[model samples]
Each structure stands twice: as structure tokens, then as C-alpha cells.
Target: MPHQPIPPPHRTYARAMRAEATKPENLLWQALRNRQLEGFKFKRQVPLDGYILDFVCFEARLIVEVDGGQHSGAIGDAVRDRHFEAQGFRTLRFWNDEVEKELDAVCRAILHEAEGRIG
Candidate 1:
């Protein structure tokens, strides 16, 4: 079943992200922080309009989302994806399992995508 889209709590969620919903995000952030990953700068838990992104690189107009099993299906995710695409941001989604079980692969995929955008 598709999960329901929980609209971001707007501006406030941006500030409280550190305390409110930091874990799932942190698991990814820890790997991307501090100009890491071949100097790829990623911003975490960033607020963009009505959404909070797992990771973003404004220069690349890229939004990388790490989704858990509960986010399965096409309904909610599709809707949210359309919104982001409409706003000129390209989104890349990966399952949490993929990130956890295939960390190097996930990192390589992200780098490959970024490289594609660069050229």
C-alpha cells in the first residue's frame, strides 16, 4: 500500500529537524557531511517550500531521497515527485535497504548521476 503524503510542517520543521526527525536522515547525512565523498557538498534535512528534503545540492538542482519500506508504491511518491520536477529539481530516490546493504553502490550511483549532470 502507498503511504500518505505528509506535507512538510513548513518552516518550523526546518528548525526542529535536528530534534524531530533526525535519525533516518542522520544515517545518510553522516556519510555526506563536511565536503565528503569526493568533495560532494550535500545539505541535509533542508526545507524547500512545503517539503523537507533528505539531501540537496542547489547548484546541481538535485534532491536525493532515501526512502524506507513504508514509502512503497506509486501514489504518494509520484505526486511528490511531480511537484519537485515541476519546480526544476531532479530527484533521485533510493531504498533504505539499498543504502544500508549496498553503501558503496549507492555512493557510486549518486556520484555517477552527479557526473552526468556536470557534463
Candidate 2:
């Protein structure tokens, strides 16, 4: 089992991460923040189970990850996904390039999944 996350430290780290978001992260955040995408609110760099999610829609129980090349075939991600799944959260992963090059499609996919969960 994964260790329980200490909220205070994790929150601090999440804040720092938000401040240093990558270009793709920034682009995706702009599209996901507030109620910009299909009236669903997204919070960036949210900490859960000692992991910071790129974006999350709490109401929809959806976690969106904007991953770079380093994440390809990462076993840690698979473990994290299982952990989130056990917490009744669904994760959607998109490559950084996909977010940068095909942002509209990414947003549409997120909206579609969120709608299924929320509506």
C-alpha cells in the first residue's frame, strides 16, 4: 500500500509545481482552468496520495496528466494509476506533444469523459 499523503507538505509542493509549469502544462491549464471547458472547473497541481496531478476535476472524479517523453512506459505511472483507481478516481493521460500540437482534441476528450462522469 502507498503511504498516506501529508496534506501540508504535499500542498506546498503542489503550489511550487504550479508555479513552474511546463509549456504544455501552461497551455492545457489555460484551457482547463475555471469553467472554460464545458463548464467543468479544473484545479491544477492538486496533490493526492503524495502525487501531484497536472489537472483534476473534483466534481467528476477525473485526473488529467500531461506527460512528457520521460513518462513513456513508466511503471511508476501504472502504479499511480492503480492507486488513483482504488480511490475511485479515473485518470486520463496525454503526451506533452499531444497537448501542444492537438490541444483542441485533448480538451474535447477531457470534456467527453467528464460529461460521462458528471452528467
Candidate 3:
């Protein structure tokens, strides 16, 4: 197996970040938290492989990122994606606007991707 980055020892920081979830993240979390979507359990602000994932479904090996404008074409994101991919995890990123404007569609897409991975 390829070497993967390990999660940093920053539980305090991660916990603080989780407390201040962005609007888009809060919105999506309403749908994803507590296995609300198709019974697929999702966790918020999870620390994994040296990154704080916005949302994670461990069973599906899926990491969902609700990105703001700053994330567009970000090289760092590419590197993060590759790191998770190396660990057999798939990442799905959605813009803040997309999540805010088309929440239903985004949820559908997330559900589809998660189901595909699960099945």
C-alpha cells in the first residue's frame, strides 16, 4: 500500500473548527448528520489523514467537501484528494453557491455517489 499522511495531533483545533461550521457546511450537515440521508451515517468535521474533512462517511469511504470561492483551482486540494485517494477514499467537492442554490441536487448527487460506493 502507498504511504498516506497521518492525521495530525490537533484534536483541539479540529474541535474548534467544528464548532464554527460555515453556513454551507451547516446546511449540508442538517441533511447528512445522524444518517438522515438514506440511512448513510455521516460525520462532520472529521480529522483524517492529516486533513479535516467537512463530512465523512467511513462506510462508503467518501469525503465530501463544501468549498468556498477560495478553493477554486487550489493546488492544495488536488494534493489532498490524491492523499485520500491513495487510501481508497473518494472525494466529492461542491461549491458554497452550488450547495446553497441547489441543495436538493447536491444531496441527490452525494447520495448517488455514496450508494455507488456502498453497493
Candidate 4:
């Protein structure tokens, strides 16, 4: 059965996402785009149902979020994770520092996690 389309995000939310996605996306996106990592494709700044995700690996059902200072010590992250979990998508979060300071490590972690999801 085809899934019904969820309502579009509010206009302000969509615009903010576009601006943030272009301006603040982590380095991981560069590596993920164009199938640079093990031929896995990723979409950046995507809308999936009610929320917009930083990066989504659709085939693997993984959502990667690059969080900034605001998310630090903020419990809302867990709540958001639960929402994605309920929808059958695994959420991976990396702080901006992790991506900027240890990009190679982040890339490896993503690869490892994705591998586990495969047969």
C-alpha cells in the first residue's frame, strides 16, 4: 500500500531548513553525496512526513542529524529520536564539533552502522 502524504511543513520551517541546510550542514554531507561512501546514496535537507532531517539514507532507513550548541544538554533530542524510531528509522546524531574535528571518525561510524543494517 502506498503511504499517504503527510501535510507539508509550515512555510517558515521549510525556509529555515533550506537556509540551514545550505549554510550549516556538516562535512559528512560532502562525503555522502554522489555515492562517495560505499555507493550509498543520501539526500540532504529532506522532509520525511512531519519533520525535516539533516541527512537521510533512505535505503538504510537512517537519519543523520548534525547538531549545534543548542542541542547540547537539551533533552528534546531524545524526544525527536523517539519520533523517528516510531516511524522505523534509526537516528544518528553527531555534534558539529565531531564532524568538524573528527570527520574521518564520523564517516567510519556511519559506515559501520550502515553495514550492520545490511544482510
Q: TM per model? A: 0.79, 0.92, 0.92, 0.82
- All candidates' lDDT scores? 0.74, 0.91, 0.89, 0.76
State which candidate has the highest lDDT. Answer: 2
**What is the clash tally of candidate 2?**
0
RMSD of 2: 2.2
Worst 10 residues of 4 by lDDT: 1-10
Candidate 4 lDDT, 15-103, residue by residue in tens: 67756663337467788899898988888777656667788887887888888888887787788788778777789898887788888
**Candidate 1 residue 79 C-alpha distance from true site, Å:** 1.4
Query: Once model 2 is optimally superposed onto the true structure by TM-score, how far is the C-alpha of residue 62 displaced, in angstroms?
Result: 0.3
Candidate 3, 1-119: lDDT as tens digits: 64445545655667888899898989999999888999999998877656788999989999999999899899999999998998889999999989998999999999999999988
Candidate 2 residue 87 C-alpha distance from true site, Å: 1.6
Better model by TM-score: candidate 2 vs candidate 3: 2
Q: Candidate 2 or 3, higher lDDT?
A: 2
Candidate 1, residue 28: the lDDT equals 68
Query: By TM-score, how accurate is candidate 1?
Result: 0.79
lDDT of 2: 0.91
Ranking by TM-score: 2, 3, 4, 1
